[model samples]
Target: MAVSYSFVAFFNSISSSYSSSFSKPSLGSLKPHYGLRVDSKNSSRRLVLSCSSSHMDSNSDTMDIGQTQVSSTAPFGLTMSEANMSRSSCKWQRVLLKVSGEALAGDRAQNIDPKVTMSIAREVAAVTRLGIEVAIVVGGGNIFRGSSWAGSSGLDRSSADYIGMLATVMNAIFLQATMESIGIPTRVQTAFRMSEVAEPYIRRRAVRHLEKGRVVIFAAGTGNPFFTTDTAAALRCAEINAEVVLKATNVDGVFDDDPRTNPNARLLDTLTYQEVTSKDLSVMDMTAITLCQENNIPVVVFNLSNPGNISRAIKGERVGTLIGGTRNSMAART
Candidate 1:
């Protein structure tokens, strides 16, 4: 069925009035927030569910958690649940997805690609349907790169980064809207207080959201300057106790050389944390890589060109580069 005319409006209610507006929703909370049905005009069965959000006003047409209907047209070869069940060998049940702003940019030189965002939302919905908890840390390079302005605009590096963090908030909300459009339960939590737009980062509360099968998008970086979203992703992953981190980028996987510039660069199936650190592979910032290594959390680097790749990566497909852990610092090379 085609998605509805959009259901929720999060800005302000979620982030602005968090202190007074936010309340923890029980996993089986039955507080009914009126929901909509999206399916064939004549479909007999319709789903109704309860959705919880901070400062949900007296509006009937708002975000709600309902049994999602699988589109007859699957994103890949199978439906969301089928794709998930197909991955009985999946190593991690809960994972943190790190998405670069550029990944959502598609062929354009700038701005968020609606197509890419919706595709990602669909794939995420698929994973959640499988009952695998999912959280995300999205970057802001597409809207504005903090460093780009810091160096060129003569702005303080600290303030420039704050701007970049705000950019991420924009990205986060956009993603939230897209996901909700498709009936996926979702929330946006931020490192800093953007009370009008996102909930301030609360570790336990964030975990609760995921436990309820809601996709939590962590935004605003670490709420500190001089830190990339990668660091934020690592930090959130550890706090949430995720099994692994899925680093989605433009490239299909980790390559020996810059695939865009060097044709000889070979796709690496796997590598150790020590190998990435020792060789200084450009997969992630050294700090982010070290954090994951110290926590023993494996990283899966994959391309987000299509919706299926995200689940395929989580399903243990050898789609992208799998960075190794401490137990084995020496594994597949290229």
Candidate 2:
């Protein structure tokens, strides 16, 4: 099905609001507070909203959870089972979701795909509702890659890397916008400062954002030229003290060889950090793999195209290849 015009128009109408929110240095700069306003005329599906701030306000009090104001529009409604499911899924308090640039493209030939973006936003919202604090690090290979263009262009390597960094910022903004449309609060922070667009990356502030249930998007690739975004993912994951790094990719899991090319190649359900690095596995860039290894952060490489896989990984359900960590003692039985 073709992407809906309503989705596009809704995003367009609020583009200025998002821009203003991120571009300014004060929360008060955002005139007319923005909130998720769902159009119920479409269907019964639940909607998620994204919210952002023009500035960081450390003094603001957290939203009260138990306070319920009477709404004249509708009567209260909730099922005990539904509430149980919500509570059970809230175990994961913090996570870092790493999405490659291609995942954002959806079915489009290039650039950001609105449908895919919205779908991801909704999935993130589902886990957030469960009380999981989420932070995202997105790649920019979909729009452009430094290595891909280096052969033809006269641009220096560092310049190309910087361009790639900027591309990530663009992707972050698109994601922030999409999430807000659904009523999910979000914050975009960059290693490189662009006051007109986002806040400068600060570890304390990022953690505070997560503490407030706000999804934080880290961009600009560590503010360095030689590093890949994968390394940035590792760095941010460590900085935020995330329990696991979910590397969402096209493949379901890591294999001894290219599964598509070698029929005998087997999918590795689990692996140790040393095995992955010593064997030169392609699960992630060597630099990123090394960083995760040193930090003892397990990496879960799974197919993002699979619906609900992100949430599954978060719940520690063993859906993908787990690398660079101590294996469970039950391995001897298996």
* Candidate of highest lDDT: 1
Runs of candidate 2 exceeding 4 Å displacement: 1-91, 326-334
**Residue-by-residue lDDT tens digits, candidate 2, 50-153:** 34355446653333233544433211133445544664654356788899998887665769888778878988987877667899999998898976776565
Superposed by TM-score, candidate 1 places the C-alpha of residue 153 at a distance from the truth, in angstroms, of 3.5
TM-score to true structure, per model: 0.72, 0.72
**Per-model CA lDDT versus the true structure:** 0.80, 0.79
Compared with the true structure, the alpha-carbon lDDT of candidate 2 equals 0.79
